[model samples]
Target: MVVLKLQSAQFFTAPCEIRSRKRGNGQKFSRIIRCGIAEASGEPAPLGQKTKYNDGPFEKVFMTLFAKKMEKYANSKEQTKKIGWWDFLYDYERFVDASKRVMQGKNRMQQQLVVREVLLSMLPPGAPAQFRKLFPPTKWACEFNASITVPFFQWLVGPSEVVEVEVNGIKQRSGVHIKKCRYLENSGCVGMCVNMCKIPTQDFFTNEFGLPLTMNPNFEDMSCEMIYGQVPPPFEEDPVSKQPCYKDICSMSNPSSSLCPKLLA
Candidate 1:
């Protein structure tokens, strides 16, 4: 007989004694399994039978991996901030250069170049130059149609027809509207949107002109995603009228005629 002891939830259990069975070779073998939580005093608290193994190596490996990942995450975050200014400048310069190159060409190539130029020109001036430098002309041009030109014109012209609705005795203003989109190609979209909306002008650091010219990267595609998302699909039914709402506000109404003469023309 062999005695095996284990700790319970709040107390120790009586030793469980088991007699070993003899094998054909006249040797006796016995197996004992216990399950429970360890007690406060560092004793095993058994609830039932369980398998056990050494976990020290696994714990050490996990800790090492976790530490490495954390270090990498911190390093990447720092790198992003450090590269932000340079990336913005590069994108701005590339966009300007590409536009010039496209303008000097002709035919289908010229049409594509014009579209690219228009889209790039629409972006905020502080986009990361690194990202712009990476874009192929085809992608840059296509992105402008899908994300930039469409969305900006949509917002400038308004999303829905203005119909007066009264909230109380006095007339109240309410209409379906698209909020300005933020750009996130580089650092993040919120920062770009703040600059576009000119929110930072309230503080002296930004000044009445907002960010200084040196800090400006002139990202023309900052609002691409924003405009793309807000600009209703050409095939989608209008929410208010249940009619096809394919017409772009800017193109149809010319709301941004004064602001974007190049586009209007």
Candidate 2:
């Protein structure tokens, strides 16, 4: 008799096939069948058996990729404090802690720009050249949102609304409303979200894909709004840049005065 082991929640996304034999006929069949996104319904976490990440092939692969990329940039220059050793990259929590530590000493603007540079280093040169330009920015944004962004984050944030919104007499081509951000909540760092995620991510999509995006994260609920094809306003005019940090922050620093200089006391 074969001993069956429990699977992890991320197993559904990995490319794996398991064979199970029929007791009576000895016919072999697949234990888990790959699925199409079109067939799934609202807020469903399907095809997941367990929650432990150790057994999750997909999670392992993604974490490894992210870690390697970070390693490349973290060691490239000794000008800043070393974030983490290559050996520590496999663990997400460890990486986050190290990243925050490396970013903590810098001012608000410097923190955002430093993280932005790290993200850009991970992208291939001439990236948007690969994407066909026959479509408008809005169309391209929508397609990318469906195929990549939404799918990539859905598992972490559950179901979210991908919307189109107008602000300041300008219409955003695409927008994604995250009811809650898992990374920010889990990492418990506002600086990490702004510097490592929001600013850098926005710059990456805008520069690489020629699609501008502005991410507005609500600290109270950990919700966020990603508006695509809309460039982030200047620091002087940006509300988020001027917003105060959470009264209680993970980095143990003041956001209004330290993290966000534009936000006056």
Candidate with top lDDT is 2
Task: Tell me how many clashing residue pairs each candidate has.
Answer: 24, 0
State each model's CA lDDT, in order. 0.25, 0.53
lDDT (10s digit) by residue, model 1, range 138-250 = 32222332332222222121121222222224332222222212112212222222222212211211221221111111233222222111222221232211212112321
TM-score top scorer: 2
Clashing pairs in 2: none
User: Cα lDDT for residue 230, model 2?
Assistant: 74
Window of ten residues with lowest summed lDDT in model 2: 46-55
**Model 1, residue 190: displacement in angstroms?**
19
Q: What TM-score does candidate 2 reach? A: 0.63
Error of 2 at 11 (Å): 8.1
